[model samples]
Target: MDEFLKWYFSDHPIVAATLGADGYDHTLGDWTADAWHNREREQVRWLERLSAREASTLDDAIDRDLVLSQLRGAIAEAAWPEWRRDPSVYLGTIFTSMYAPFQHRLKPEPELVSAALSRLAEVPGVLAACRANLDPDLAAPLLVKRGLGQARTGRNFLTRTIPSMVEDPDLRARLAEAAEPAARAFDELVTFLETFECGGTWRMGERLYTTLLREREMLGYGAAELHEKGRAAWAELDARMQEVAVQVNGSRDWRAAMEFLMDDHPATLDEMRAEYEAETRRAQAFVREHDLVTFADGEECLVLPSAEYNRPVLSVAHYMAPPPLSSSRQGVFFVPFTPDDFSPDQVRQRLRTNAHAQMPSIAVHEAYPGHHWHLSYIAENPRTVRKVFRTPYFTEGWALYVEKLLQEHGYFDTPATLLAHLDFRMFRAARIIVDTALHCEEMSIEEAESFMSTKSSLSPGTAQGEVNRYCAWPTQAPSYLTGAIEIDRIRESFRGTLKEFHDRIAGSGGLPLGLAEQVALA
Candidate 1:
């Protein structure tokens, strides 16, 4: 058990350092082809060691649950081509490591500079690892958008973000010298990827896809059943949205009515921030006032603009939890502005996603009673396993579940807000259609984005980015609606207050929804 701590401690030293952990204060771990193969081998051994344990099952359920999550991931890491196909995995690692040391000063000044300098120097090696490891044949061509976007972000981050974080003149000078090579590395990556005459047939097919649902998410049904589930959700949400649109003085066609809400958004960027901040506070206050869910005592949230490192992956808003081991515990809720590099129409569309009517619900989802709230409780225990394992089904599901819960409890408070809330429900429902269809080889990138834009009423560029993510991740897109469906079922099955229901699930340590239901009822 103790070995597990040392083994897991800084496996991804930069990730650990980002979360304020030590032992990685001056290094970016190996990013070579051999290192990744080693990672796969280690995953196998860890799973074997975990399965070999001879404890009573009932007594060790929490540890077992955590291991189960890691076990599924280990299987996929061995089976899947992600380290090769997904450029974000490499790009994210490089860019994130460069700034993560500064994000958390886990050590004193001298160490921080040396750490940052060492990581900055290693950026070229990491990018080289990306080139060496990625098999162009397995790469999803649709993700070229992400690759290109990240290349731009790499240049921008070094020019803008890195300097601000590295305050010391000599350290800043070293980072500047290292910046050119990292930027050149990303540029070379972009040029290399563009040469491929490849297609994005990134399907998991029937059997393994179904196995992912059954084993990883603990679902009773398989891929085909979930397809029907998604289709049904899409139909139901659209109908409900049309019905709600009437209250907003919207046209009978819900799409036309949603346009009204889109136009009802904040006029300028500053106006948008004020609205988001105010609504964030409102959502936090409502959770506390209504006693909707338990908030972690003394946990504070800082509303900030999102980082440039992985923009398209994170999109408009994301939450950063306090390091599981940090003394200063505060979570950051990042709300990003549209990049100036985008075309005017792209900016308009991205801004609409941050529309006034939707901001409060987003506030609820990202901050109070959602990610920040859920994680705050999860952070209370010193359980390293929980920190290591997160199933999208539970994490994203809980966030969406709370969005719906708030609407049902009159948190929307107005017809415009009601329309905005439905907009997101339908958006998630649409991801079900797009995610499976793309991976099932039923749709092209164009077709998938069209489905998303039509279903969610988002702009083309915004929809393109959304579908771009689905191309990289097969089953994750469906987690939003699929997980919410299970939560709704569990909510109806159990006889208890909402707070009691959520607290029980929270206590279960973010189990997959099906297993969570079993534990919650038990």
Candidate 2:
């Protein structure tokens, strides 16, 4: 299993780089149709080989099941026609290939720069492969527009951001020299995407959607069942939010209460950053004081501003986990303030989205005892498969689960803070509904965005971005709610203290929830 895992990582450089695997910084993945087909064939053979083997112990059996699940998911994802239809497929590869080398300081600056330049030289080839793989007839217009936006972002990163980030004059010169062609390649991609006659739909349809839920996610329920579950969860959360709203502002008008809380935001980006940093510390202390869960040794988190390039896509905040394989274990919590180019009104809107009332919940979800804390343990785990194969079900679910855990433990003590937390929870519930509806041919893109806007606290712009993401990536948005539900179920049955249960689950790494249950309960 270790040998196969190493081989798989080596064969896919982008995946390896993202996972912080060594010796892949100077390379990129193959995006050719032949490469995709070849990978599928190899994975199938491994699947067959692994399926025939029997395990001698529970741990070994669990490892085998994890590997098997990963293989099946990879194979199923490969069979999807995304490579032939979605321009974001190649655009994402391009961004990550260039971006991964700079993400961590595992290597010296000179070595990382060299690796990045090497990738920059390969960008034209990647774009060429993208040109060859994509068919306009199968391309969705929304995805094509998104690809164009990403291409522009990639080009700016190559031409403007990379050069500015370098301090050494010689390295800066070399990087600038290498980035020109890559920038040009992006310009050409933008041109290609601009002329693309996109007539295709982004829906995965019932068949592929069901297969992903059952095979990739290893869920017992299908899309329809999940959709119904989402609706029920939404109704329940809605009722709770209404009750909280009455407590907050003496009315059942939840939206009005939410808006009032949002108005109480930090006046500037620096203030926002400070609040989040403080909240992160407060949450960490609360966890330790309550013995919520054990933290990994040397795990640390830093609050920072989002990169200029990332601000376009990341409306508010996000967490960037350390590569499990890298020497650095410091995670960054990125708070994206409105860009300088935005108007004053736009800035206010952005600030409102990351308001004071929501800071505690956001900090809890993205930093302490959420992604940063959960992933730190995964990084410390010895098993390669445990570190390599992550499902959003466990990862996002665990984060969401901790949000509620903290709430239960009094981290969100005020009516306003609790209401903000519930609002975020309701957003995830809406995601489950929209994700299933969009992919199952039940909702159009506009309708999905509208549903998200009406049902959640997301701004119209953020809601549209969310919808676009759901269209491009299926089975992910729902994982937040679905995974949380599964984790709660596991907790209900576990015969242990809350801290012990959390430790067991967090230490188990981001397995599929079913397999995660086995590890947590064992």
Candidate 3:
């Protein structure tokens, strides 16, 4: 199963990588639609080649129905893609960076691009074949419309998002030059769509659309449930933030407290990077101390400025892919270079982002004990089904939960630093309200932005980018809060049951800590 699962995921690394890119946490149409369709035919062919027995289970029934339900729903949702008015719609970032490697294989000419897209149209037929074989009926117009609405929101992101080095004129100039390649590349893809066909006998409607949500939920948690979890988790974190805020700035609110800390705790970009590297090394030490999992020898961290290809202006910081499982090398924690114009105060705020993305607990979130640890473990997983089926929500949620866990474990001793963690949690929780309200609850983009800025006191520029991520991708933003909440609940339930905190990590080597009860539940 492990061998097979590796082969399976490796077969679609491009699709997986594209999906892994950022969203702030929803599946934006532009980032996914073209590549998604491009691979559908190949996926179908892959499925057809699988022996019926091989297709049926990784070993035994790993909730096979749930998997099929998700796949069918994806087919349905892809039928009538909508175009939104957001800049996130067009440019693929780190998540979709995998798409870049394939670009050199294509011609820039519109005719050639069109022909390629037309060839991709063959996917619908393959989907139809699957439908003929399985005859799934999952009609949910509202769900399909939800997809269309999401696509509409993403349309704006395609054309005019800025470079990540917002304050650097030279890099800024370099980025603009960089855009030439990406713009031309994206235009070629868009041009291809003109003659592209969506074939297959399977109709796109309600049932199929709903199934996608259901499958994703099975992989993670239900959307409505996730929102509730996010809200509840936010409330708890808010209470904690209040405590920390008072400690930092007596009687002041979180906003004033954060500002005070930013002003007082300012660090230069170089100083900030050094601190991040030190913090990350400390995290690695913790992982080793706990004997949590295997580690790469002398695994150096990578921290660099965000590139122009995918990173848009107002971007904070993010991580890149770790070394492949076979490589046995450490992953990178990329810190986008700050511009000279950024105030010391601004740079301080950016430093907090390192903690969010790279701290030991965050390392657990991004590399070991989180994405890398678990992914690497699963890459080496004995169970084929488990290895092949990657759950983004589970993966991301676990990482977010790790950040919170660090604080709970008395990791943040400083009042200001603690405030940063609380703010991060709030930022994620706010995503639930922002994403759901924006896409599903009919909130205008401005209303969503206002909600983020006024409610959180985050800078307007940051707030806009955050809201755009939620807008472009729908259910995803809530996952950090939701996934973290779920993991917390499970841990609380097992507080006395487990002998050691790190022991739990060892016990559930490749599975999510949150799902420990599922086997019993099943």
Candidate 4:
């Protein structure tokens, strides 16, 4: 399994870089259709080879389950040939490559610039290959919009951010020269995506969606079941929020109260960063003071400005974790800044997401005992499979689970803070409904955005960002709430103290809830 894993990682340069593997540093993954098929074929081979091994032969239970899950996941991914269907894959990669330097802190400044320049030189060829590989007929309109947006961002990165991030005059010259062609290519690609668009549903259909849930996620629930549960959860959240609203004011109205909270926001970018930074320190201190769980030594989080390319899909804050296999453990908690061109009102609107009420819980969600804590713990583990296979169910679910855990443990001492925390819950609950409905073709793009605005506290801009992210990765948006609910359910049933259960969960290698439950219970 170790040899097979090493071969798999080294074969895909992008995956290799992401895992912090040593070799395959100077290359990108093959963008050709032949390479795509070759990867599918390789996954098939891995499945066969892993299946031939007996599960009982593996000494550790987590190891045994991980091997099975990894193989099944590999085979499941190839079942649909989503490489042809998912335009977001290519679109995301374009920007990821562009911002790889700062996002991952992959190398020294000189080495990083040279590597970036090497990659920038190949951007045109890469975009051309992606253009050839993508099927216009399978595209969701939102994807076309998203790809075009990112492509534009990439073009701007070549012209703008690249020149600024590199200080050396020689590097700047190389960057400028390489960026010109890449800039032209990205513009051409964006135009092509815009002009050659085709009409299609983003839904994977019941069959593919079912296989994705059952095979890929190894979950027992289906879209319809999850959707219904989401509605139920939303209703319950609304009911509780109404009582709180009545207590806070005379009326049991959610929107008015939520809007009031949203209006209380940082007035400037510095204020926003300062607020997130302060909340991060507070959350980390609270976790340690309370002994919520073990944190890695020096597992500190830094608040940085979001890359221009990522703000389209990311929310007010997103955590850029260090690669698990790497020795450096610093985590970046990225907060989006208001663009300089925005007027006072626009700036206020952009900064409203980090309102004082929600910043603490959001800080907990992104920094302490959330993504950063989870990844830090996982990095310390010796198992190779743990670093290689990341199930959104466990990683996302754990983070969401901690939100409620802290709330229950008296982290929110004020009505406003508690209300803000519930607001996040309501948002995630609404996301499951929107994600399933949008991907199942039961809801239109406009409807999803409208639903977010009406049903949750999200503004139109944030709502659009949520929907666009959902469009990019079907099933992922729903994972936050679904996984959180599942972990909550497991905790209720598990026979252990809170600390034991949480430690078990944190140490479970980020397995799917179904698998993690057994480990948690044991």
Candidate 5:
């Protein structure tokens, strides 16, 4: 198992670096077709070897299953032809490879700076491989446009953000020198994408989509059943939101209540950051006072502004988990306040999307007792497989579950705050519908955007941005609600205190819903 893990990390250095694995900081992944084929062959061999081995204990069996699931998922992904169809795959790889070294403080600044330079030197070669692997005819038009946007973002990061992040004159000079060619490489990619003729569709279709849910995600239901489940969830949540709307204001119109809450947001970015930070602290205190779960020692969650390049796509806020293997278990909760570059209307829309009343739920969801809290415990687990093999179903589901748990515990006693929490839940419920519909060819992208806007009360721009994400990442959108439902089922069956149930499920790491139930119930 350890030998297979070492090879897996080495073979996928970008992923390893993202996961905070050492010895991969100076390397980037090979995106060439030959590399893909080689890795696929290697994965097959490892899968066979692991499968043939008998498990010595329950922990061993679980670890073997986790590794086997990852290998199967990777092999299945390789067969999807995404490398040939999506330029964004390569562009995203470049951004993550460059970003991870700087984001995590696992190594010294000098070593990280040197690693960044090494990766910078490889940027041109990676872009060349991207150009060579992608077939214009097989590319989706939306993804091609997205690739161009990402290329521009990458160039901006290389020429601007990277330099600003470095303070030492000598290191800054060296970075600038290496970054020039990388910026030019991004420019070249932008040009290629601009002229790229694409005829492919973004839909994964029912068969492939179903395979992803069943095989990759290890979900029991297929896409069709999941779509129906989404519809049912949306209806239930919509009804609940309507009831909460009446409690918030003297009316049943949820949109009106949400708009009222939006109007009460902070006037400036500095104030917004302060608000989030305060709310995060409040949530943390509440959890501790309630004894919700065991807090990991030395766990710290910092609420800060999102990086400049990430603001355009990040919408409102996101959580950055600490590296599982790192000595520092400090997570970052990034809030993307409205940028000064946006027009007056755009700025208003952005602020409205992240309203004042929503801060508590958002803080609870992304920070304390949500991603940061859950992931901190996972990081402390003795099993490396638990740390390495995570699924959105577990991670996202746990976060969503906590949001409701807090509400039930009277943490969100205020009608407006509870309404905000329900609004977020309704949005996830809507995501299930849109995600299944889009990939199953039941709805068009335009329709999905409209459905999201109407159901979630999201701005057109925000809805479109979200739909694009769903198109690029199939089967992930449904994980939030699906995982929450599964967790609720597990908790219902668990014969323990609420804190014990929370601790047990979270400490088991982010496993598949089935495996999570097994561990939690055991």
Candidate 6:
């Protein structure tokens, strides 16, 4: 068994890095079994390819140890944080990313989804046993939220909207029409999920967090002092936002100016969804015209409204995970489709949210040049343990950086429109402060919410909700601020080093979609 395990371990890193999974694939689920099968196939492909890459003798004990070491390292690096927090649920995140795109492709029988989820439920135990043999100091953190962000958004979606939709036959029919096959698969998988469990409770302690922080730093950050840096960064972004607000509203107070933008075009949910779809198309055109980034063949994206049950009561907006690499599914920008009575203004607010969330610049971050792009690029690039080991700061930082780059490059040609972009950037920065202060520093949620409201110009309700999420998952929110800052630094360094070569950053075949085009240059 150990020898068999060693052979398995040797191939696992390639599988993890080349065929990676994100967090949502763990916590929230789609209604399909085929997704699981697709992921399994990815693992198999990774193993077969790895075997072909290294013709080294596999019969020796030394080869076995070497292979096993790499395998254990990959699993430990990715799974330990969760295991330390709770040995039982560590595997939840390991399998999450594979579900959506994989399922979309393989479309396995529904029973397969249920069976696969049940099998995954036992992964924590297997990981715990392996951890017993490994060095705790070198172990990985379980569940990095980057992959899981969508899951959090999805959980919020189901908890809030499913009940109401179920009550309305017509609406429920529409939802099922769009989501049934996925939902049914999800229901089958959920039976295997431990509903009573709290994900954070199973997280690592100070020591583990410190170790993970070190691993994160190795990815180019100077240190793991997220709290102080996050606060200071947020403060700076607020100052930038203030300047934009003044530009947009000459004599108007900045706070009032932001609110006016929010209140300006309040509409029904349907109207908001339509506007979102339109804005994304416009944003894409802007990217093409300015030569910001290139979209790959078959990279079709969607801007749809979020189902009522899944909408966050307090979250102004969120982005869904990009589709898996092997399967060419476009990412979706989901807006909340609330009723007309629920603050008709909320609908209009959603339009701006969608514009920011689904913009081509954002698509670059979340999809093309950001998350999806980075992941796909790394998949085909050099083989390093770190390749499979993503640092959220690097990934998220690049995304945030892209958002600002779009604004600077004249994507926001109008004042009021650009003001909204600044406001959103400020909101992201405030998230850094709110998340850091609430978690590491032990600030109360209310205090954090107040800080967000005043600094980011968010509503009290929305502010509270963002604060809550940061509290539930500490260190995660800091990724945006810290990530953007690092990406900017890298870009500046690259520009200085290769001033004439900067155009090479976006040249064809530089880096695949969704990853940082700049990182490839770096």
Write one digit per residue (lDDT tens) for candidate 3, span 177-247: 54444344444434433323332221222333234445544434344545566677678777877887888
Put down candidate 5 lDDT per residue, 424-474, tens digits, no spaces: 998998999999899888899999999988888688878888999899888
Residue 511's C-alpha lDDT in candidate 6? Answer: 22
Model-by-model lDDT, in order? 0.75, 0.84, 0.47, 0.77, 0.85, 0.46
Deviation in Å, model 2, residue 82 alpha carbon: 1.6
Better of 2 and 5 by TM-score: 5
Query: Who wins the TM-score comparison?
Result: 5
10 residues in a row with least lDDT, candidate 5: 307-316
Per-residue lDDT, model 1, residue 444, is 84
Q: Relative to the unseen true structure, what is the C-alpha lDDT of residue 500 in candidate 3, on a scale of 0 to 100?
A: 51
Q: Which pairs of residues collide in candidate 4?
A: none
After superposing candidate 6, which stretches have Cα over 4 Å from the reference? Answer: 1-103, 106-210, 217-225, 307-329, 336-389, 495-522
Residue-by-residue lDDT tens digits, candidate 6, 1-522: 233433333434223322333222222232122432343454444444544443354223223233333333333345443333332232333333223333233234343333334434443334334234222343222322221332333332332343232434554444434443434333433332323222343223444444444433333332236656766766665666667667766744566677766665424556655765666677666656765544445555666665333343324434443333344435555555643344755544455444432344444455444454444433343323323334455556656766687777776677677766666666776776566555444566568878887877666755665665664455567667666765565566454343222223322112211233333343
List pairs with backbone clashes in candidate 5: none
Summing lDDT over every window of 10 consecutive residues in candidate 4, give the lowest-scoring window: 55-64
For residues 83-198, write the lDDT of model 2, one tens digit per residue.
87887778777676666556666777898898888888888988998888887677788778777766767777887777777778899888988898888898898888888786
Q: Is candidate 2 or candidate 4 better by lDDT?
A: 2
lDDT of 1: 0.75
- Cα deviation at 311, candidate 6, in Å, is 3.3
What TM-score should be assigned to candidate 3?
A: 0.63
Candidate 1 lDDT tens digits, 15-87: 7666566676567788777877887777778878777776676426666656765667568646766777767
Task: Give the residue spans of candidate 4 off by over 4 A.
Answer: 56-61, 67-82, 103-106, 167-169, 338-346, 493-497
- What TM-score, over all chains together, does every model reach? 0.93, 0.96, 0.63, 0.93, 0.97, 0.61
Per-residue lDDT of 1-522 in model 4, one digit per residue for the tens?
Answer: 678777777666667676677765566667788987887788777767766666654336566566667667666656555556555576677666656555667677778777777777677777887778777666567666776666767777788887777778887777777789888998898788778666655666555666667766778978888889899999999999987776555578977887888888887888888989989899888888888887776676888888787765566677777777788678788887744445786567677767888889888898888888888777787777777777887788888889998998899888788888888989999988998888787998899999998999888877878787887777887788888888888888878677777777777678876677777776
TM-score of 4: 0.93
